[model samples]
Target: MLQDSFGRRFYYLRLSVTDVCNFRCSYCLPDGYQGKPDEAFLSASELEAAVRGFAQMGTQKIRLTGGEPGLRSDLPEIIYRLNRIDGINNIAVTTNGYKLPQRIQHWADAGLNHLNVSIDSLDSSTFHEITGHDRLAEVLEGLAKARELGLTVKVNAVLMKGVNDDLAAVLTWLKQTPVTLRFIEVMETSDQAVFFRQYHVRGDDIRQSLLSQGWQPVLRDVAAGPAQEFWHPDYAGRIGLIMPYSQDFCATCNRLRISSLGKLHLCLFAEQGIDIRPYLQTGVPTSELVQAVSEYVQGKKATHALQSHNSGAMANLSQIGG
Candidate 1:
């Protein structure tokens, strides 16, 4: 296992296969990333090798991320290849659900169980406003398809102060839906100077808002990352709160992120990391990759310095595999 200096065993890997996203969410891509579409994306074979290396190091949980992982044409092949790894299990994908309707069956056939779909608002017009796309109906179709395929789907809604902060509508709709709903605080993951100030919403405010609207708690935490979950009697599903800024879950952090360019990041808020794509190109021994990964994690910081939300002047959140 990749154990860090803080005695944390890194068992989770969030790999960005590509940095190309279709939707242009205001919070994710405020200034607009002009990176070319043909820009380098990790190959299926290379991704397999990287997963094998991590699996050899006792990493079992892997989440595929990207500007939108669906942008990768070979995602199913990549998932199939990762499923073939001996020690690797629990493969998941984080996407915008734009392509799920047509590909959910194929993805499920490739051994994927969990999927996180970013759905900002239940209202079609508001959804289009947030995602800059008129495909809210398409996303809903995709979500329905995933449900029909029996995939465990989680809808991720980022709460922006003046934007999609009205969880009441989302809450009302979730009362009959089967998918889990999670409200994420708009993070300053991008280099936008006013990103947090303009978008960040407190998780407490979200919880209180839901409660005021008559939403009930489930009395248990959902094992879906850092989200604190709640539920109502009428809903068979649950609601989640991701308070990255209001509170830090760094002490329980056991995951490492690898950007689409093959840069490994120990913390999402960190500005620098090691590039491993070149190492993959040279066809080094898997042990070498393992050793390199383990060595880097040893220097991992205990917690991100997001106290001021002004550090880590990195690329847009979408480009960083958020």
Candidate 2:
């Protein structure tokens, strides 16, 4: 198995199929945002090859991410290919869930078992203001379809102070759904500074607010992925907090991000990533590529500066395939 310098086993890999997205979320692409780069995005076959290479090196968990992964027409085929790999234990996707209702069954048939969708607010107007679109109803319908298809569903909410900081309202709305709700703290990225100034809520504050509203924490161990999970005493589902800014969890971070343009990022806060596209284009053997990946893994910092002063710059969460 591939191991990092800290002896952390490298098993999870997030692959970006494209950087182009349909929605312009305030935190991700904000208003007046320019379009994507002219660089050619990796085709579905190329993505499959890279995933297979990682799988051969003992990577077990693979997640497909994009600015909006569902925008890709061949997404089901890509999922099918990745699922056929022998070493992959889990195949998941992080999507905006705009097209989920139409594609949920196809994705499930393609062997995608885990799905995490981005939904910032339950209010229709607030949703449009945040996402620059009016597809909130469609996303909710998709969630229901996903549940019907037997795929594990998780809702990812980026908690901003005044935007959707009504923890009580959000909790009450989510209590009626079976999907796990994850509240994510906003991080400093290049997209829009308005969100940084307008609504920067902390995870602890969110938890405290929930408790104040009579939500008792049901004791439980942390979940396996990046999210720190908590269950409500009488609630049907659980709540997760991913505090990358206020409380970073880089120590337990075993995942790496591979950009659509073939750059390998060791950490989410990393300013630059080592580009392995040239080597892949050279027809290098899988072992050689694995060795290069190991070198990159060894370079992971023990912690990120989001906890302290911001010591580094990170790509936009959408660009980095959150």
Candidate 3:
């Protein structure tokens, strides 16, 4: 297993297939995705080789992320290849859900069993204002289809002050939808410090409200992310909170990240990503790739510095599919 100096063993890998996104969420890409066309993002073969290396080191869950992974035309093929890897038992994708209604079947057929979609608001007008896209109905339809196909679906909503923080409607929908809805705290990045300060909402307040309303905490699975899940007997769905600013949030860290350019990131706010693309090139031995990855994880830090408002090299969340 890949154990860091702090004794945290990693079993999950978040791999960014592309840095390009089509959505213009207020929190992430307020200015829109401004990047050169067809940048040198990871190819299907390169993604497979990277996963092979991680699997060799006991990584069992692989999450395909990006600015929006749905933008990748070969994403299904990438998922198919990762699913065939020996130690990888779970394959997931985190997307904006723009193309999910049309492409979900192909993804499901390609061995994807877990998915997390971004839906900022349940109100159409609010969703449009937050995401810069009028696709709330369309994305919700795709989510229904995903459930019908037996994939574990989760919805992520960023908790922002005076924005989509009102969760009454989302909770009402969850009573019937039977999917997990996770509310994420707006984190500070180097470039978005002002926005973060203005809109940040504390997740602990929401957790306290849920606890008072009879919601029961659920134990996390070994491969689960930072979301603290809760269930209520009156609702069919569960609630989760990703409080990155919470105290000791990284104590349970069990995942590493790889950027679209194949640089290893020990934490989302790490100072820099260590380039390991050379080891992932064609014909490189799996052992060589594994060695490069193991060495990087050995240097992983115990926690991030978001509490101090230091985002390090992470100017934007999309850089590593945060």
Highest TM-score among the candidates is held by which one? 3
* lDDT per residue (tens digit) for residues 169-192 in model 3: 988998888999999999999778
Q: Model 2, 58-138: lDDT tens per residue? A: 788888998778878899999999899888878999998887899989999999999998899988899999999899999
Off by over 4 Å in 1: 208-224
Q: Provide TM-scores for the models.
A: 0.92, 0.91, 0.99
Regarding lDDT, does 1 or 3 come out ahead? 3
RMSD of each: 2.3, 2.5, 0.8
Residue-level lDDT for 225 in candidate 1: 68
Higher-ranked by lDDT: 1 or 2:
1
Whole-model lDDT per candidate: 0.80, 0.79, 0.92
Model 2 spans with C-alpha error above 4 angstroms: 209-223, 246-248, 279-283, 307-315
lDDT tens readout by residue for model 1, 1-322:
6788888777778999888887888887744557888977778877887888898887888899988888787999999999888977689999988767888888989989888889898888888898888887888888888888888899998888887886568766777887788888777654555767877778888788779867776553212366777777777778998777655568767788888878888788887768887657545888888889888888788787777665574657776676
How many clashes in each structure?
0, 1, 0
- Model 2's alpha-carbon lDDT is 0.79
Q: Arrange candidates by TM-score, descending.
A: 3, 1, 2
Global lDDT for candidate 1?
A: 0.80
lDDT at position 127, candidate 2: 92
